[model samples]
Target: MYWTNYHGHSNYCDGTHLLEEYIKCAISQNVKAYGFSSHAPLPFLTNWAMPYEHLVLYFKEISELKQKYAGKIQIYTGLEQDYVADFNLIHKEWIDLPQLDYIVGSVHFVDRFEDGRYWEIDNTTEVFKEGLQGIFNGDVSQAIQRYYALTREMVQEQKPPIVGHLDKIKIHNRHEHFFDESASWYQEAIEQTLQTIAQSNAIVEINTRGVYKKKSKETYPSHWIIKRMYELDIPVTINSDAHHPEEVTREFITTAQVLKDIGYKTLRVLWNDQWQDFSFDEKGMDLK
Candidate 1:
């Protein structure tokens, strides 16, 4: 049994270690396929994203690593691109570069700040509160709604192969401090977003970043949400969202079991140069 993870990071962005370190760790963990998904380069002020100047170097190094590790593991290139639609910030077209194997479209920046910086919902809880008070005037419902709205908009516009970390805005709602996840409005927002995803060819990734990082007790979409996705017949892929070598498959053991319990018999995986559904167990996917 071997793991298949595509959403990961490296020193090019916010992640630790060089690109090759992650590959070595993946091999040690019995991983058969992996992808380098550094945070896509941004046009505006942000410290975490890869610099626009680094794109060529990132691609070149990955190309070299792909050839070096060809027979040992399946390596692919992808980026976690954020969908920004703030007119307040000057718009710049995304730079064209060598083709990527896939893209994990995500909504990290909900909206821009008054000074023109973007509000990252995935950042420190302090930043979230600041944005909530300053932007939404403390209206959690409105804030959550806007997040989902942007998510749906990104899906419609980009139609990326993978929709990353659905419902990640809930990361700050721990202990129900802000609002109830079971609230009618919250579920409605999720339902509406799922409807949009259902119509598209995009696959929803069951992200384990929140779980292993201790940010949440459940995966990005949570268990009930994955069940909802199953009802809609939305395909899913399990991703570690690894930022470190040791975290490559951090919570996959339990996540896979939870998925199976939720009636997911197969997972979407990129294998043999194609994304296909394959049978899997808690240990790992059956690539045989």
Candidate 2:
């Protein structure tokens, strides 16, 4: 059995270690294929994303690393692209020129503040509450709806190969303080978004970061959503969304078990220069 992780980060963005450090760790973990998906450069100033000035250097370094690590492990270059209404993957000039192996389209910003700052949905609990009051006037349902709406729009319009953290907006709703996942409105939003993703042919990543980070009780697009996904026959991939070297495959065993219990017999992976499904167990995938 061998493992693979496509969502990762390094010092180029808000991540801790250098890019090479993550590669070395993946090799130690026996990862067959590893992808570097640093937070993509945004038009506006943000602390987490790769700076606009470093975009050229980021690509150059990854290209060099790919060659240096060839045959030992399969390396892929990608970006966790954010989708705002005005500035998205399609509109980004530099993103179009680069030869990205894959794109993990995501929606981290819901709407802009009155002063024109993009409201970050997953940054911190305080910031989330601020946006809840400022943007939706404490109407948690509307704010959550808008977040899923942005995701649906991205899938329907831009339609990247992968969709990152499908239900990440629920990170702050840990204790059911805002709304219940079983609520009819919440399920409707998720179902509608899943329908859009199914039509777009985008793979949904079952991210484990929330679980390991203690931000949420389950993976993004939680167990219930996974059940719904199984019903819809949506393609699913497992990603750690590691920002630190040691976090490369954290919580993967438990997550795989969860998937198994959900009746998922196969997981999608980018292998042999293409995305394919392979049978898997808690140990790892049967790539052979």
Candidate 3:
């Protein structure tokens, strides 16, 4: 396929593959480009993040892979930086690092009022239902309000090259609890978020991490979000959010076809400090 993946994980983080193995997966799929946007070194987030000590070797290995695989496949060095409550305290210096070809800024935790701490809230109905207990001591709507606020801050402050899974909060709540899917408030929150992204000139990745997780057949942002993106004329890209080689460019043809059906002619690729659109063919990935 003439597609490029911008979000993927490697053994450096919580992923299961090494940089080289991931590359082989991409080449087998015949993807035009592959990017290693593994979770960046988060000193505070020790559980699921890469360590700062590995930063030197991280770049070294990817740089070597990039050179060795040049012309065979376009490789990018990138990171998925989380939007912590105290952004400055955790990310400022790390983002300034030299090897990062791009960054996918994401918000995975929602502020919880139970212990006055941030909790990992993924919008699964069970989790959302349980999460309600800690959100302002059972204020579900308030939780949504604050989650949207964090989304705004992620866009405004981080100014990430791409917004990772804009509506990822709904990943777990698909068929159970609908987050006002037909409500004006929900629509407005999304519209305002899209306006901010468009204004910033950033891309929103169609992350397929959930698909592999069996959470849904959809990616982050889902079908509703993708359709809305078409209305706003926002730019988009596809990422497996791969943690293993088998996931490299996983469901890429399906994702690309879905985008094409929704009026997207191409996906955005970052190169030389700007986005370049790569056109798609109608017959899907030739893989010849």
Candidate 4:
């Protein structure tokens, strides 16, 4: 474990720990670099995000920590930019701002309605099947189509450096009862999404947050999606989405082993506006 972890959180957002706590945890874990990616401040985004008012403070804290631990470890600052079409209009302004090391582009809200409000969308068969049936009044297929369309739009428009947890909304559907993964329409949507990601040259993350939640058997993107990604040769990175110190590198080794089982030899890491491959150690992937 050379100690390079890019997905972590702090008191600035929903994370339970402070920035310093996570840094101390990284030092104890012997990690070389730890990146903090709290939920980005979205002006019009719903109440679930860190307010824009805290941006300066967020930077201040990160800067202070960076100075304090300069030689002991590497600390990078970032945000998990939520992929909303309207939000993209000012995306570059935010991405280009000061003190930002990188970003993890994620789509937590599938659609935003009038009044600039959004609802939680579960892109799975079971939840969406029922929710769509009720919310859209029995037009479940249309909802499913819209969900995929939204996903594709995010990939095309945002073109993030890394796609966060490709199939995150499916976390709780381990029994496979939600939507039919075998269904032609669903399968096509997934295939198209993967192709778009590969074409975008974006690194896909094997997020283990859901696994820690105990809601799913596999990490984000699931085995089905991961297998297809392997076939397509799309680049990948591992993230814990940790909100606390102890959770900083949770399940990283297991996730690495899983990737190894699927024939992945290296993982992507960001540096100088590009992603490069780093060899995995399997049993010793996180020895730091």
Candidate 5:
């Protein structure tokens, strides 16, 4: 069995280490394939995303690492591109870069705040509350609906290879403070989004960041969502969304067990320059 993680961050963005450091860590951890998916450059200023000017160097560095580590472990270059309504990877000037192997389309911003700043959903509890109050007038349902709406729109327009953290809006819903996941509206939103993904060729990632980060009790998209995905025949992949070297395979074993219990037999992986499905267990992928 082997492991792969296509969603990761490095110093080029807000991650803690250089790309080389993560490469070395992946090699040590027996990760068969590793991809760097730092936050793509945003049109406006932000702390976590890669600067517009730094994208050139980011592409260059990942390209070099791909060659330098070839034959050891597969290296892929990607970006965690955000879907901000009309502004998305499809509209980015650097979307056509040849070095990019794949993209993980995510929605970190839902709508704008009163000050015209894009509301960030996962940054902090205070910020989330601010957005919830200011944007939706404390209506959690409307805010959650908007988040899923943006995700659906992104899937329709951008059609990225992977969808990052499908139900990440639940990150701040600890103890069901805002609303219950078992609610009818939430389930409907998720089911609708799953229907869209079922129609497209996009793969949903079983992100372990929330679980390992202690932000949530389950993986993004959650167990119920995964079951629905299986029913829809939507492809799925496992990604740690690691920001540090030590986090490369965090909670992967448990997440795999969760998938297995939920009746997932194979996971889509980028292998030999193609995305293919391979059987996996709690340990890792059975490459053979």
Candidate 6:
């Protein structure tokens, strides 16, 4: 059995290693298809996102790696774009360019700080609290509401091919001090967003980075939310959201078993220039 991963990073972004290191590690992990989805250039100046100027080189480098790794693995190029509508990043014409194989849209920020900086929700505990109180006047419900609203808006209008880390705003809510996931309002928001995703062409990715990093006990979207996605018949793909070479397929096998337990029988994979669903188990997919 072999794995297929479409979410990964390299030195071009915040990832620790170069592109080739991830490819070599993926081959060792028996990955048949791997995609490099480094964080795309953002409007704000941040150390994590790739620089806008590097996009040309990012595409150029991935193109070369594909040929060099031919017969060893299938490589695809993608970007983890931040869908910040206020900055018009999501509507930028450059996103739909031919150089990209796919886009994994994510909502990392809700509103902006008084100083015009966007409030990133999944950052450190102090930053998260600052946004919660400063932007929303300490109204946790309102903060969470806006986060999901941005998600719904992105999927409805942008319709990114893959939605990254669906419930990542909860990254700082680890202790449930802000709000309860079982609360009616929280469930309603998730239900509405998942319903929208079910209607759109986007695929929801079950990200394992949160779990492996100990920032979250479960994968993004949580186990119960995943079960709800199954009931809604939402298409899903498992991704480690790897930022390091050895993490290409981190937590993948256990995450697969968790998916299986939630009643998922197939996973969507981009292979041979097409997106298709393949039967999968704890080990990997039955591509043969």
> TM-score of every model?
0.95, 0.96, 0.89, 0.87, 0.97, 0.97
TM-score of 1: 0.95
Clashing pairs in 4: 1-286, 1-287, 1-288, 3-31, 3-32, 125-178, 125-179, 126-178, 126-179
Whole-model lDDT per candidate: 0.88, 0.88, 0.77, 0.75, 0.91, 0.89
User: Where is the poorest 10-residue window by lDDT in model 6?
Assistant: 85-94
Off by over 4 Å in 6: 89-91
Alpha carbon lDDT at 110, candidate 5? 92
Which candidate wins on lDDT? 5
Model 2 global lDDT (CA atoms, 0 to 1) = 0.88
TM-score of candidate 6 to 2 decimals: 0.97
* CA RMSD (A), model 4: 3.1
Model 2 weakest lDDT span, ten residues long: 88-97
Show the colliding residue pairs in model 1: none
Cα lDDT of candidate 5 equals 0.91
In model 1, the runs with Cα more than 4 Å from the true position are: 87-96
Poorest 10 consecutive residues of model 3 by lDDT?
Answer: 279-288
- Model 2 misplaced regions, further than 4 Å: 88-95
Question: How well is each residue in 26-106 modelled by candidate 6, as lDDT tens digits?
Answer: 999999999999988876688799998899999999999999999889999999988885766544665688999998888
CA displacement after TM-score superposition, residue 118 of candidate 5 (Å): 0.4
Residues 1-288 of candidate 4: C-alpha lDDT, one tens digit per residue: 564678887778888977999999888876767788988887664544678899889988998998899888778888888776556676666777778878888777655444445545644455444555555665644655666666677778766777887876665356555566677877787898888888887888888888886867788878778889999999888888888789877888888888988988888875433466877865434322
Higher-scoring candidate on TM-score, 1 or 4: 1
lDDT of 1 at 278: 91
lDDT (10s digit) by residue, model 5, range 42-149: 889899999888988998998898899988999999999898976754446554668788999999999998788999999889999999999999999999999999
Candidate 2 on 168-255: residue-level lDDT in tens?
Answer: 9888788547788899999999999888887878999999999999999999879999998988889898899999999999998999
lDDT of 3 by residue, 17-44 (tens): 7789989888887666778887887645
Candidate 3 clash total? 2
Error of 3 at 176 (Å): 3.8
